[model samples]
Target chain A: MPSRAIQENFRFLVLEVTKQIESTVQVVTTGDEALIDSVYLKDDYIDNLRGFIDAKCLTVIRDADEGDERTVELARAVDIVTNNLERMADFAVNILRQYKYVKDHAILRGYGLEPLFAEVLGALGKVSEAIFKADVNEALEICRSEFNLDEMYAERFHRVMSELRAGGEQVEDLVTTLFIVRYLERMGDSLLNIGEAIISLALHERLKIHQYWALEETLDVGRGEAKGLSLESIFETRSGCRIGRVRDHREGAEGNLVLFKEGQRDKLLEERAGILFWQERFPDLVPKILSWHEGEHHASLLLEYLSGQTFQQILLEGTSDELRAALQALGTTLRAIWEATRVDEPVQPGFLGQIAKRLRDVKKVHPGFGDDDQTIGALRVPAFADLLRRAEAIEAELPAPFSTFIHGDFNVDNIIFDPAQDRLHFIDLHRSRRFDYVQDVSVFMVSNFRLPVLETTIRRRLSAVILAVYRFVQTFAQEAGDTTFEARLTLGMVRSFTTSTRFVLDPSFARAMYLRARYLLERLLAHEGGDWSTFSMPTNVLRY
Target chain B: MASDNHEFRHESLEDRTSIAKYLNALSEAFANGNLTFGHNGHAIELEPRGLLKFDVKATRKRGAVKVSIRLNWQEDEEDRDPSVGSLVISTSGEGK
Candidate 1:
């Protein structure tokens, strides 16, 4: 809480519009025409005030240092709140004009507008208080107002449809009546925008309504109390999920925390299932799922945040001994899981198919990767598209002799190392499935290869790490009598190397990955064999 | 190590006058059948042969404007395959 108050004009603008909304309710209550016209005229004043506040916000932001996140976020929230307030005022004037179209107020009663108007008024009152006082609970109430408006509109809409279907008279009046509720819905959306801006102001991070709800729900479920607990979002993923860590910040509340994730329903479902699977088998090897909830199209997963450094942190920052210890622990975990969960089912990994699915994304990022077939005197350079068909032919015969529970996207970042406990944990398990262990192996190798560390010493360390894992997995394969492990690994590496490029933006790095794919495809095309065991992945190719 | 590799690459946003100047130079080069492009210690000189490929493309989609002009021709002294198809990586554990 900054002892210095927020700028007065922004507060004044929001409060002024909120007062107008209350007065509009009064007009709707008393059916006063002159008062309605005054509400309509006051909308222009709100618009001008919005402009003044917007410029003042920009000036405040421009004057603040870039590192002053608090000042910048405050200015941004004020700007967003003012804009949404102006929109609500505009919607108010629109409703007043449209209400005149209904000649007979009796026929206009679908579900009634009084309840909708009252909710908007309630939500608008909170916006001024939420922004000025930095009240998160009040902001949440404003968000719930949007939800309430939706329910009222849904009921009204259902009745309107029935009346229209009945082929009754006064269709124009019925439709205009619906438009009034629609305007209410629009005003509700503005309130949501204003509420979210204030919530973002309080948390110092911007959040969507679903993400805010996810955090609130997770907190409530985790400890049966969400009041007085502040939220801080760690990051928002490209998938539009919220990943945050929650803490009990009370005086005696020390070191009790949980990782909160809210994402697409299907993704969180997969993650919950994966965590349960790992819990049933190796309890300490993955995070404990504390709570889970699904709302609308999104889901929230609350897990005890594991206490350790990720393999990524070890590789990038820790000592060489730490890296080696992490790798060895990872190898041990893989061996245990593979041995325990290995199923006797011959599975073709469809590595080429995986590459094919992601080709569009790859070309979307690096358009030049979509190469054309070239003829150079005596040589035929098949296009990348042509290479896939040829490689799929080789991939057809080589299937792993068994399937195991594997992390579908097993990169270094997902694996956590707790040196104190000498244990490994997995997070981000949305992609877990019963598949060939080679998929995890290939991703591990490519992940180590493509670490973005160009320093000579660290690059060598990555190569060594890749080699160590490859040897460990290869020994496991040999003992399991998976004869075609090397061949399947070749195809798997090609799939990983190619699809991984789409996620990277550095041109040279993407090129390196794309060329490796091309090189592997060329190798597959050149090989003539039904004996898959003779095929081997080149260690040199994986070095860089 | 004389090779038939002539490379000229550029990427930037050119204003109207700058583009006109570049186009005029290209037009004169086309008339003379010779073009030289030089920048930052990298340079290339080319002379058109019997057959030349000219490709022009303009795209306006997805909030982007792209214009490309390409001219290519085979060199007279080109007798090699001009392919790295013989590239082979050893599977042996040399690092071991």
Candidate 2:
């Protein structure tokens, strides 16, 4: 069979690379120039073997049975594996060459070099399982090996640079050692590429190596004591946090699923604080934080995975009754939380400032959309920057009449709905805070409107949801005598719609949103120093 | 997801003679499973086939009258990349 042929050739290629690595390590450590012959001798064999494997890959893919998905995936994976392995073998040769330049061959031994070799070799050992068995945990270990190798290289590199800077007689040795460490770091990078390729093939989706490592480490630290765990990448946020859902297959841990999130330290800490705030106020409304961990400059959290579908899912695929139920549940939760945590103090959210922070990203996507001040016969329109400046000033003067603890993101996806329990749960609490409730209300409306599905039916559902949330919140505002709610909501919408265009590339759709944002800015600019309560938000702008 | 999108749009008033000619051309293009629209020195090509969603809405409010027509269909992505943006929309199931 083509598969058997490909596997056998691949096995031979791997063996050749392994031998090359082993021989290189042996010569570098023993300080024996004669041993370098074997390393050089094997280089030709490794290169030829890689070429052979590459040729076989083309053959199998071209001649295999049609629609043989397994063969196709395996072939593609082998293609990636051999390419990285060849580069790694080349790096090993590069190291052997650099080793000869050092005045003292023994000098390489002084800088924790053995363990770094071990880490690289150890990663190669797992390459088999990563490719053949398609073991995710094995792939995770392989990827983490690079991070470990980097730490080792960093320490040695610092000493080498420092010694060279000191202008010592051992400069040759230190500089050569510097070149050698760089090769080791390159080997680690190849290992990462090989591991991620296997993982992408195994999962039928591309998974980044660091993201895989993050998920594994979070599981290891938090509720990861349970064995036989499987991970699936769910979503990643613009904030660069890797989000995944994990299922525990350990005995008695069946159906135990949790979400693992890892990102910059401050972001995760903020999320932890948000969760704690909700837990104290209404525990059931937010996902319970299972565990939290921080190291270096990053943090990870294991959150109890609510089985409920997100509100976005309900709008797309749920029955009418289910949609209504979720909407009703969400409304009730918002009302109760607002009433319970309402603080009678004025608070300015800097919604326009928030837009300014992301304006660069928006410009990155829609470069020509940013406008300069323009004039008609009887009118002058301010530039986007000038409008934002005015809006910021206006926002400072017209703070929300009251403050309440609110979902900082308030996206449709962050809110989960459990049909079985008829409960609503929130996730990604990093942005949760005591802000103007209008911020949450406006975010929810725009999130619904921004969903890319544009079939008429879903659009109607989105419009209905936005309207329902608007009327519901408007009633709450009127009851609380929050007369400035409309004025603030328009500004909030301006922030969301303007910034959200970055995520969408549909030109017509993006322009619609950008134009609406500009129109709102104009309207807001036109109403300067007016009675804030008299300012009414044109709700149709929130409609799809 | 990395988005590579093309767009075509135009806004102008037209007489029935021009409107009829433009729409007749559009109908022919749609029937041929290929449509290209141009505006302001830019053009976009679209492929429409199989079942399509058609929508129309109209309103006559104040001193203005408006009408909108929308067409929707799925693109054929036989070799769609599994990894795009982080967002994945899927129905709830047993497990991955």
Candidate 3:
């Protein structure tokens, strides 16, 4: 038996311990993607949280020095909380173990947005600084002005994605850009959150308290248009060089910015080397490559320095219909790539092409192969015999077309809309490939309408938009005597035919893609005078 | 870590729920000589000390209890010596 007051104190301590545990866990959970994924890091965070809980519990017990019986009861309560808190830590650690990156460095040479990313990070840093300093006007100005860099980057990104889609470059580059852009966007969101939190805290009149300022901003500028370096030849330095004090202007932009790492310099040099190679192969790709000296490395082609609002930066500022316009611009930009693209290299016995080959082999081995769960599960639609059959049938009707570069990565944020010129500029063309039109279509569709949150109707409308743009682009390619576009389109159509049900039935992104496919097919049928519905795709294809 | 010389006694006071009325009754009883100290050989007072210790020792007994306690004391040098205390009882049944 214990006194009522001692019992009440014991219960109050238990509740406080619980509250502290909850708050600490919340703090530990909030962070970047890497922090959220790893079991080891998550476990460490949980353990740290539990340790705090233990300290709080100990404090409660020590402060409440009641008689022996009451002290004993409180001590027991502390032990109970300690045990349960430890268990919660274990659960958090288990969550992080699933996402591990295997590669030391994946090639990202193709998505050439070094300049754009540099500006993005710079703008983000300035905004964060303004928010930290409580300069609301500066914060708003940075938010408004950050989109100006989009024009340069978006065009570069589009060109790169186009090249990759056309199978002109490696798929590895495309994968890297996907991760890079996703992270960059997320980083932008984090900065916004920090700014909002600061504003909220200030409104409570608790401003300028508990400031621990240590935020890092990094950007890498690669190759041409930014060559030559000297502390003194400062004005001679180019846009890609690190911003710093001016020294001289005799030598071209080379080895100048002392702030930049040697690795960054090497990367820029690599880009220069790559540009030389590109110029040698495709002389007309850039208008008359300029040469400071008569060497391949010395040649420079000056592209228009783009400084306009990006669709993302614009959307962030909340001007309505801007995002849709940006999306449409992205779609149009991809359509342009689809119109002029072809595979520069043969499908080099790679995984995707191999799968297509295997589909052919498997069909030969088992002519009566039925779509059993095992068979369906093992099959990729593009590699299926039926899809290849449709592609072969469609290919015979189109003339052989030359392959032009296509951008493999096409997303809205990579587009820069210049209202003055009424033109959209694309950026990051490192992953420029010479592949089929379908590759471009897939990239565009996945990037544009692959959102997890889109409703069915909107998804359908978006699908329609994609197919319409795809067909329009393919037709243009056809008119230009580029039959590869038609071939690519045929392959894509065959794929759609074989896996229409699977596309439609996907529990996840299916409904969206299905609607888009339906819209595209309907338009395609109307124009081509052949009903895709009458083609009779089997129901077994809906294995997904 | 309080002053070791402070004296404390474990008194077997009556379990009183009604303090005022019961105290008054006890006072009247004491005045009327109905209650007496150590009545019917009952011990009500005890001596207390810091770090209370208890031990048992066996000794030869004559036709009764089989064991007896060997009590010892250690007092602070500046303090008065502590009073030694113990309780002794014999089994009711005779040892064969």
Candidate 4:
């Protein structure tokens, strides 16, 4: 009978073999076959050693039956090798099956690999348990039987390979299957090696010496690595904390006033910058960051308190025009932030990728009026392709503009008002991205404004006002010689922005929006009679 | 339970204490609660010290008007840092 230590060795060998087979098959089945084929045998020095142990385990069991002194020594040797092999082979069969599944599908497996390997390893564990039992002399005999298994596997492999050689075109399926068969054969060979090692341990006093050295190194290496921490410090600190605070002046005013924490420092300094910037641009924004220390955890701002009821609260009491005016104010605040950022630059770092990503995310709403989810009545409009054309024409007619900084997120919440001052201030400056002028305007139209209240007519008029302001801002940029581009590239970039969002909006609305937008764009394009592709703008118009 | 002179001194201290309490409550309520003046001049300004006191004045062209009020001593950091606190309020006011 095998010792506990030998049983553990057998278990490890079985599990390791199981993992290798499963991972290999998972790769072939999952369309990661090339990746698996590249690394499958890179670390398989132990297979031969396991084969030797399985062969020897039989010897030890036989010696025990004969009551020889060699039986005890053989058991100890089997203990080490069998334990290692069992652990390796436990997932072997499932891994082969996974490869088979991947080959049959002839496609890349959609799921990730980690879970597949885990499940296979879990199932192969039962075989390892059988090896560890003291009374299982009969179970140890299986190790002696796998020399015959290898012959069967080799024959199957040859037959499949021969069939593949005779196959015609459309061989992806056949080739995939053949690859699966090869992985399956290798898996059988690994398991057979384990069985042979178990048998060998039963017959001899010592198992393969080469396996012990490698196993020791592998185990030591695995144990020496440090593990990652379970939680990040920021998340841990904020777990139960709520936003906003109230301080009692008389009881403890002194401690709360001097800001010291790191988060507070960044927050306060940012707030100071925000206040100064707002004072320069739009003075109406309230809760002004008065002064902030870079050392404080949060920014300190002076707030001009708002006393009026919220728009939602006053909905019943207000007239439609007042509601429209309030919403228009929100729209204006959003546009102000966009206008301040010089988004017309092309080569600014982080500009291209962000624009491209945003372009990709905008919905591809159907342009037809009859679609079930149409937002606007059917309006025949040029496809995104045509919009690109019109944009190109405009670009050719216009001068190339340099890129400028733009408010990255021009949303409703950033707007603040003080009726006393009749002022509007925009806050939350951290999302400053550089892109084309239209990027800010388009995103504001889609994200900030509601569908029903903002029809194409309103958007068109608002966009005109925004464009007029943009034109004024662009003059400053233009004098700086930054707004230069060939008409075509400008059109392409603008088209990309509009189409990107058009893809995401409801089909009917998208069509109406796109048609109206194109009408405005065509007016710009017609103003410039030349083709857009022939135009060019200076690249170095905006600098960091 | 005290002498007449002692009692008189105690009453004087009580008046000062009451004033502090009253002013603190008024200042706090003005900052936090929704107390709208009918016109521009109705407003409250609070100083940073522990005392609770306020000056209610008329907006642009209006005269100062008497108003009914209630006060509570809620606090806010006069600035952003949590270390300092200024009384805030959950107070109410009615125009006369």
Taking the tens digit of each residue's C-alpha lDDT, what string does model 2 give over A1-544?
A: 3467668878777777887888788878877677687778888888887888888888888887897867777888898999899999999889999987877766778875789889988999888767898776677678878889899889888888888888968988888888989999999999889988888776665777656556667666332232376665567787888777877786767768888888898888898998998897687888888777787898888898888899989989998888888888877778777888889999997888889899999989988767667764377856787878877777887788889988888899899999999888898887888889888888898999999988966777787788778887877888899988888988999999999899989998998788778778778878998998899887656655
lDDT of each: 0.78, 0.80, 0.38, 0.40
> How well is each residue in A1-544 modelled by candidate 3, as lDDT tens digits?
2234433443443343333333323322332444343435445554554565456556656666566544434344334434443453333333222112313223343344345445444544453234334443344333333344445545656765776788844555455455444443433343334343433222222111111010001111231112122222112233342222221222554422332111134433443454354345444332222221112222122222344566545544424354345445545544444444444443321212333544444334343322321232366333233333333433344433344455433444445676555456554343445544455454544444443434533443444444445544544554565534433453343334323323223343443333333333333333343433234222111111
Cα shift from native, residue A221, model 2 (Å):
5.7
Clash pairs (backbone) in predicted model 1: none
Q: Model 3 chain A: which ten-residue window has the lowest total lDDT?
A: A209-218
Residue runs of model 2 more than 4 Å from their true location after superposition: A19-42, A58-73, A88-130, A135-213, A221-227, A349-398, A452-454, A494-511, A514-536, A540-544, B1-96
Error of 1 at A201 (Å): 1.8
Q: Which segments of candidate 1 are over 4 A away from where they belong?
A: A1-7, A36-45, A98-114, A153-182, A219-225, A238-240, A249-255, A342-346, A363-397, A477-483, A505-508, A521-536, B1-96
Error of 1 at A452 (Å): 3.4
User: Per-residue lDDT for B1-96 in model 1, tens only?
Assistant: 224575667667789877887789889998998877888876677777544545567899998988787876554322334321211112222111
By TM-score, the better pick of 3 and 4 is: 3
lDDT, residue A323, candidate 4: 39
Q: Looking at model 2, give its docking quality level.
A: incorrect
Q: DockQ score of candidate 1?
A: 0.02
* Alpha carbon lDDT at A536, candidate 3: 28
Better of 2 and 3 by lDDT: 2
lDDT score of residue A508 within candidate 3: 34
Q: Candidate 2 chain A, which ten residues in sequence have the lowest lDDT sum? A: A221-230
DockQ of 4: 0.01
